[model samples]
Target chain A: MKKLAILFMMVGILIVFPGVLQGQASLKELTLSERTIQDPMKSWTITFTQPINKGTLKKQNFLIKDDKKRQVKAKLSLSKDEKKVTITPESPYKKGVTYYLYIKGNVKSGSNAFLNEHTVLPFKIGAVPKESKNSSGKTTTNDKQPASSSGKTASSGSDSKSSSNASTSTSSKTPGKNLVKVQTKKHSHFDEISVQVSDYVTKVKAGSNEFEYKGNNLFVLYQPGLKSGEKITVKGYSMSGKVLETKEVVIP
Target chain B: MKKLKGIGVAFILLLSILMPALNQSVSAAAAPRIDHTSPAANEQNVPIDTDIRIYFNSDIRGISSQYIKLFEKSNGTYYDFPIKTVKKDGEALHILPEKSLGFNKEYMVQFNGPAVDLLNGTYNQHLSYTFQTNYIDFYELMVVNEGRLMNMLDTYAPRQIKAFAPKRYINEISVIHKKTGSLKGDQASFNGITNIDINTKSEDVVNVHVDIMKDGKSLQKGYASKVTGTKASKNQFTFDIGFSNIPDFYDVRVTVLNNAQQTIDSKIIKFAAEDGKAITSFKESYKYKTAGNGYTFHELLSKESLFADLLAESMMQDIKVQVEDR
Candidate 1:
C-alpha cells in the first residue's frame, strides 16, 4: 500500500508541476501608454515588441470586458507590420466605465513562441464623472434616442459648454491640425450630412443625433424637413469623450 | 458655479495627463508659413457662409484682425468687410464673418505682416487671395468614365460629365487641364489626348471649353465645342482635348459655369494607370523588374555535387582505360 501511494504521488507531481511552471511564465504584464481614456470613441493601439502570428489574433486571444465583466464587442485589426493591434469598440464605450483589454497566453508570436502571459490592461473612460456639466449648469448625459426630427431637445446638451470643451481639448492636441469637412446636401424632403473625418474621430454628431464612425474617412447623416440655405452644426469626438472639432455647414 | 469649478478642475487634470503626449508630438522649430488656405487662391464657387481658414506649417502665437483683412468687390471698387472673429486654433487661423457673404460676388483676402511664430520672430509675408461666391447649389457633379475601360486615354476614349442641379441654372461645362505626378523623361515633349462628353438636363444649351493652365496661369486657348441645348434630360455632347505631359500624375478639372462665366460646380478626376502601367506613357518610360539571385547552402552543395560526380566519372574512365592497356 505504501509503494502504491508513492507511485501515485510521483505521478501527480509530474502532472501538476508543468502547469504551475506555465502559469508562472504567463504572469508577465505588458506596459501600456495610456491608462485613463476620456473619449468614449477612442481606439486602443497596442504594439507588441515582436511580430505576432496573424492566425493567433482570434477572439479567444484578444478580448475587452466592461466593468460588468461582459465582453464588449470590439474589432481587432493587425497592422501591416504585424507588430501592432488596434482594438476598436463596435459602439461607444459607456462614460465613467472601466474596461479591461485581455491578451491571452494562447497568443503566439511569428516564430510560434507563445506570449506566455495573460496580459490584462485596465483603462477607464470619461474620468471620474458620470455626467458632464455645460456652462448652463445642466448635467449632460448621453442621449440614446434614435435620430429623428423630434430629437432636437437631446442636442441641447451640446451647447456652449461643450463647444468650450472642444476648443480646450483641441488646443492640447499634438502633432498637427485635424480638418473636419462638412457638406450638407439638400434633398427633396431631407438633408444629407456628409463629413470627411479622420480615423481619430470616434463619433460624428449632426445637430443632436450621433452618427456611427463606420471606420471610414466619410460618413453621412440624413435630417428630415431640412430646407435649403439652413445651417447645421457638426461635431466630432475622440475616444476620451472630448470634442475634437466643430463645424457649421449650410444646406446646399 | 460648483459645476463650473468641477469642470475647470477636470479640464486641468485632463491637460496635465495629456501634456506628455503633447510634448512628444510637437517637434517643429521653424518659422510659421502659410501651408494652405480654405478658399484657395482663384478658387471658384465658394460657399457664402464658409469660414475662411489659414493653415500654417508651424504654430503661431495668435490671430490678429489687424494683420488679416477682407474686402468685397462691387462696382469696380473694393469695400472692407467686417470680421466677427479671428481665432488661432492649433496650427490654423480661423476667420468668421459677421454675416453671410453676398452671392455671386467677388471677395479678396489680404494677409499683411507681423504674425508672431512660435520658434521664429515673426512671419511678415504679404499674401492676397481672391474667390467668387457661388450662385446656385448643385446636387451632384460627377465625372464618369463612359468607355468602361479602367485606364482610358486619347480621343478614342469618351468620358462623361453628369451634372444634377436643383434648378435649371447651369449654362456651360468647362474643362481645365492640370498636370500632376512625375514625368517619365522629358516633360516638355510628352503628350496625350482625351475626349469629354457633357451630359446635362437643362433647358438651355451648354457649351464646352478645354482650357490649358500652366504654372497657375490660364492659357485661355484650347479646344472648344458648342452643343445643342435640349429641354429634355440626359443630353450628351462629346469633345476631344489634346495635351502635353508635364508631371507624372494626370488630373483634369471639370467645372460647371453659370451665365456670368463663374464656376458653380467643380470636380477633379484623377486618371488611373491601366494594368499597373505607368501614368504617363512617354517615350522614355521605364518599367520595374524584380530579380532573385539568392541561393541556399544546400542548393549550392547540390550544384557542386553534380560537378564532382562528372569529374569522378571521367577519372574512373581514365583508370579503366589504363587498366585495359596494362
Candidate 2:
C-alpha cells in the first residue's frame, strides 16, 4: 500500500483537474450564440466528439434548471448522423435570470463509447453593462453580479443560503463541473471502483484499508471482506477538509 | 446481544467439526461403481459400429485403465483388437473401437482388480459383460496361410508373403479371431461394408475397375483381371482387386460398369496402411446409414467379439475426450 495510496491520490488529482490531462476539446461541447437572459429563448447546439445514436439521445439527459435547481422543460433532437444535437426550451428565457444546463455523460456514441463526462453551462439571458468591470479588467464582485438592475428577478440572499444548504446533502450525485462521477464495475477477475471527486473536493478517500488507486479508479484486491451484498462507503473531502460527498459501492 | 453472539460462535464451531467427520464416514463407505453403461450389459443386436459410454457413480482414477481389458472371444480364445477412447472423465468413459465389429458376433470385456476412485479407495472386484451384435452379415477377403497373410508392401509388411499367396482373397472370414498368429492386413481387420454402391448386374458380366489414387492421381488401375475365391471364381461383387505391385498405401476407388459399358456405381474404400487398425469411420457410416442402392450380402459374426469391440471403442473415445478436456 504505500504505492496504492499514491495511486489514489493521483486519481483524486486527476478527477479534480481533468482538463490538465485531456484537452478540453476532447469533451462534448454546447454552443450558445448569446448567453444573456434577455428574452425569447432560442435553441442551443450540443456537439459530441463522435457520432451518437439517435435513440440514446433522451430529453431527460438535458437538465435545464434555474438558480433554485427547479427544472425547466425542453425538447431534444439529434441530427441524422447523430453527431450534433439541438435542445429547444419550451418557454422563453426570463430576463435577469441565470439558468443551469446540465447534460449527463451516459449518452452513447453510435459505436457504444459513452460521452463519459457531464458538462454544466451557466449563462444568463442578458449582457452586463460595459462598465461593470474595473479598468484593470479584474472580475470583481460587481462584474460577477447579475447585470440586470431589476429587483424583481434578483434572488433573495436568504433563499440562496437555504438552497446551498440543501445542495450539500447529495453534492456529487451528478457529474458536476468539478466532480467526476464514480461508476464502479465488477468482473469475474477484477473489481474496480472509481473514486470520484465532487466540485469542492481536492482529495479523495482511497488509501489504506486495502484500497489502492490504479489510475482513475481504486481497486480492491478482488473484493473487500464484506459479506455478500454488503456495501462499502467512501467519502470525498474538500480542500478545506469538509465532506463534499459520500459514495457507496458493493461487490459480489 | 452478547449471549446471542456466543451462541452463534458455538453453533459454527460445532458444524465445522461434525461436517468433516460425517463426510469422511460417507466417503469411506461408498465404493466407485458403474452407474450405467451404453449397449447395457447382455444387450443383443447392438449396432456393429458405435461408441460405448460408461457412467460411474464415482470418478475413476485414470490409471485404472490398466485394470480394464476388452477383447473378442473367437473359437474360445481372446484376440487383442484396436481401440480408441474419446472421453474419460473421472465419472464417465467413452469408448470408440477403431473398427466395426463383425455381424452376429459376441464380444467380451472385463474390468479387473484395483479400480481406484477419487478418494484413493480401491474397488478390488472383477466386472465382466458379454453382448452380441446383429448386422447385415459382412465378410472380409482373408489371406490365410494358416492365419498369417504374406506381406507384399514393404519391410514393414507382414514377413510371411509366400505363406499366404496361394489362398489370397480366397476365403471370406470374420474381422477378428482368437487365433494369435493371424497376420491380417489392416483392411482385413475392418468389417466389410454392406456398401450401397457395390452391386453387380451379373458377377461375371460386369466389368469392375479398381483405381488406386495417390494425391488425386491414379497410381495404378486394374481391369479385366482374374481374382479367384476359395471354392468358386471371385465374382465382381466380392473380389479384392490388386495392383500389379503393392505400392505404399490406401484409398482405392472401385467403379463398376454394366455389360453394355454404362457406368453403374462407384465407391472409395479407405484403409489404414499400417498397425492393423480398421477404418472405423467408413464402417460406421455404412452401418448407420440407409443403403441407397439395392444391394447386400449375407454373412455372420460372433456376438461376443462385437460386444468387446464396441466396449473397446467407447473406452478409447473416453480417454481421448479426457485428454482433450485436460
Candidate 3:
C-alpha cells in the first residue's frame, strides 16, 4: 500500500511541474503612476511588479516625442527598490505642448523576465487635455491664478455660487461671526473695536488707513473723539480678487 | 522853587519804592497761607481713609512734625493721631493714618506752635483744619441721565460705570468704537462702548492724572480728583469716554498718575497695528476745561463733533481682510 501511494504522489508532481514552468516562461507587465501627465512635466515614472536587476537593466533607449513626434532628450534612473523607473527631462518642457513617452519590453527584471509589452504614455505640458472639456467660460486651463481686481462683478445671474476660500493652509473662515459680540476696548481718548465677520475681508477702509490685508475676520476701527453713529463699509473679496460681498455698518 | 519841585518829585518816587519794600517786609513776616487743600476746609462726607494734604504759599524751612499734628476729636476730648509725613516743612503736608478713621467723626490737622518758613517768614497763628470723615463717594457715569447722554439706546444693559471702571481724567473725552459691521441677525451681545471706571478710594492716592496713550503717544491727558462730600462710599471716579473717532486698530494705554503726576499704573486698553508715524502727542488745541461744573469727558466729545468725521475718515484705513482661493 505504501508503494502504491508513493507512485500516485509522483504522478501528481509530474502533472503540476509543466504548469509551473509554463507560468514562469511568461513575463510580467509594467505600469505607470499617471498615464496622462499634466503640463510642464518635471518627471515621469515606470513601476515594475518585481525587483529589477541593476547589472542587467538597460540604461538607454527610453524615448519622448513632442506633439510633432520629434524625439526629445530625457534621462532615466531606477528607484532604490529597483521597482520604479524615473524619467527626468534634461531641458524644461515647453509650454502649451504635449509629449509621448515609450520604453521597449526588452527591459529585464531581477528574475531575468522581460516586460510583457512595450510601454506607452501620453502627457500634456501647459496645455488642455484631449479628453477633458471646460465650458464654464469663467476660468481656463491657461490662467488658474489672476491678479487682484476691483469693483463689483455685476453678474447677478443665478449661476452656481462658488465661494472663494482663503488661500493659506493656516487660514480659516471666521466662524461664529454671526454671534460675535461687538466688543469695544477703551483707550485714553479713543475706543478700539473688534467686529467678527462671516467671511474674509479683502479690503478694509477703516478711518483713513485703507489698505488690503489677508486672514482678518475681526474688523477693528478707531472712533477718534466720539459722536453719534458713523458708517463703516467692508468689502469681501475672493482670493482671485472678485468682490463677493460688501458690508456697511452704522455705529451710534 | 523849580529845583525843590524836582527834588520833591524824586522824593515821591523814592517813597513809592520805599512803601512797596515796607509792604513786602510786612507780607513776608506773615505766616504762609494754605492755597489748596485736598479736603476743602470744613468739607463734609470725606472718606474715612482719606489722606490729608495741604499746600502752602511759602516753603517752611524748619517746621517740625510736632508743629503739625492730627487730632481726632471725640465728644469733648481730642487725642493726637499719627500721620504719614510732613514734607518740605510747611510747603505741603500729607497725613495718612495707619487705618481708616471713625465714620461721622471730625478730625483736625492742628498746628501746635507757630509755623515758620525760610527767610524769617512766620506762620504766626495756630491753625487747624477740622473736617468730618465719611464714606467715599461713588462717581457715576451719566451715560443715560434722562436724555442727557443715552448711548445704549434701549439695549439690554444700561451704560453704567462699574466700581472698577477705568478712570478717565479728561473732560468730554469720548471713546467711540468704530462701527462694527455686525449684521441685523447677530444675536451676540455687542459691547462696543467702553465703560471706564476709576476706583477712587480716598484711603489711597488722592488726585491723579490719567493719560490716554496710543502706543507711546499721549492722546489725551486729564486730572482725576477724588470725590468728596457725596453720601455714598462706593464712589469710583469714572468717565464713560465714548469712543468717538479713533481710527481702527491702535495700541491704547490708560495711564494713572499720583498726585505728584508720576505714573503709578498703566494698562493696555486696546491693541492694534502700531503706527510708525502716529501722532506722537494729542494736540493740546482740543483740550476742554470746564469752569464751574466739573468738565466731563462727554462734553469734549460734543464740543468737537467734526473730529468724529476726521476719525471716521481715518478709521477707514483699518479694515483687514482675509481671502482664500476656492
State the DockQ of every prediction: 0.00, 0.00, 0.04
Question: Candidate 3, residues B98-217: lDDT per residue as tens digits?
Answer: 555655578887776765454446665677778775432121122113232233223212211111112223232223232211112222112122223344333334454544443356
Query: Chain A alone, model 2, TM-score?
Result: 0.38
Can you write out model 3's per-residue Cα lDDT over A1-252, one digit (the tens) per residue? 999999999888879785755542353222211122333546655554445557645544356778898877877787788755667777877765767666555555565544434444444542221121122223222122111111011111223221110000111111111212344555434555555532222234444443312123445555555444665554433222433343455555
Q: Write the per-residue lDDT of candidate 2 for residues A1-252, one digit (tens) a residue.
A: 899999999999899998777742465442211134333465656554346656667866666887888888888877676655767789987766778776655555555544433445565554322222222334322122111110001112223211100000010112222224555555322244555432233344533232322222222222322354657665544323334445566654
Candidate 1 wrongly placed segments (more than 4 Å): A1-252, B1-29, B137-326
User: Cα deviation of B317 in candidate 1 (Å)?
Assistant: 99
Kindly report the fnat of each predicted structure, to 2 decimals. Answer: 0.00, 0.00, 0.07
Instruction: Give, for candidate 1 chain B, the lowest lDDT window spanning 10 residues.
Output: B317-326
Which lDDT tens digits does candidate 1 get at residues A2-52? Answer: 999999998898787867556535454532212445567666665554566
Query: How accurate locally, in lDDT, is each candidate?
Result: 0.48, 0.43, 0.43
**What would the TM-scores of all predictions be?**
0.22, 0.24, 0.25
Among these predictions, the greatest lDDT belongs to: 1
* Pairwise TM-score winner, candidates 1 and 3: 3
Q: Which docking band does candidate 1 fall into?
A: incorrect
DockQ winner:
3
Off by over 4 Å in 3: A1-205, A208-230, A234-246, B1-39, B42-66, B69-110, B117-326
Model 3 interface CAPRI class: incorrect
Best by TM-score: 3
